[model samples]
Target: MTVQNILSIPPYHYVHVLDLNSNVQTLVLGPKSYVCKEHERFTCEPKRMISLSPTEYCVIRNPVVTENGVPVVDSDGQVRLRMGECEYRFHQDSFPLYPNEEMSGGVEVLPVVLADSALRLKARCDHVDTDGTERKAGDEWLFEGPGEQTGSSSHINCSSVRCTEISRSRLLQCFIDYLQFETRGIHIFAIKNLSIF
Candidate 1:
């Protein structure tokens, strides 16, 4: 049957199939592809088949070590993964697997909208400085909003901060009000405001 004809039927849309040779291919059947009872007939006995969501992505990593072409485990009993790359399987996108390549996990990117607020980030792992100084984890950073920030790779904790919106006129009035207070006969003094959004 034609791809359009197959897709028109119930429970058929798209399928990602891994062949016996470990080659991965994606068959686009329709817009809303998923795993269903009818997938086996179209898969032709693949090693594995899964349904991919357009909003989600997978991480492909090359094993750090291998024995006889199989991935080797580290002392911690976990496969050592390095040189990670992302696979964005938007409709009909195929993921070809290389030798000793494995998928780490799938991730779905969620949208966050911050209005009149800021995003606070804390490092979860120790960061090594250029001079060999280890900046311990828990180091905090801020992304001021009403703006857009893109992170390519992040392993941190995130929290939202509601900013205190003060108009320019109100800020100036507060400064003037503070100056009116007794200051040991000092007429002029420096005013410093060190508040993070």
Candidate 2:
């Protein structure tokens, strides 16, 4: 990813600088004034008390990124959750999942909940083009939609399953169509609802 693609600002907000430490020899970047598609990951939080599909799962965790061991902010200046190497940015109000090209078909991943212990990192929109002008929204391409959770989990309730990884056949047989419905080419399915006969 180019430097331009690595830095970006969240939607509907302008970058604001909290403080700058010129005295310190080490580089301490201020809050996010901009967001980059290459450097940042964004996801909307799921509604509470909602039942989700078996094929669908969620990751509830604390943020990994820290500023002086604190949380980070998005382009909108909202606190973010860091999982692994990814920096997931969201807002206090309803956030949008963007659409994009190079998209494929798969089960829709439901929203997730972030724990309270995550650190808050700030960003600034200091990024500009060669012409020395602020970048416009249309200039970039970011994707928002139902995204799948792709990390290891410790909350599995099944005693027989030793690892998180399982074959499609095993999953289907275990759930017995209660958790999913069969699709011709798609072995794994996520359903909206199920009614027992």
lDDT leader: 1
Q: What local distance difference test score does each model get?
A: 0.43, 0.30
Clashes per model (N, Cα, C within 3 A): 0, 30
Per residue, candidate 1 scores C-alpha lDDT tens digits across 170-195 of 53222332222222254433444433
Candidate 1 overall lDDT versus native: 0.43
What would the per-residue lDDT of candidate 2 be over residues 1-197, giving only the tens digit for each residue?
A: 12232234433332222222221111112233434333243221211222235444333334334589455555554455443322223222322122111112223353332332211111132345343544432222111223322222211111111123455555322343223322224444555443323
Listed in order, each prediction's TM-score against the native is: 0.34, 0.18
Indicate the residue-level lDDT of 40 in model 2. 40
Q: What range of 10 consecutive residues in model 2 has the weakest lDDT sum?
A: 95-104
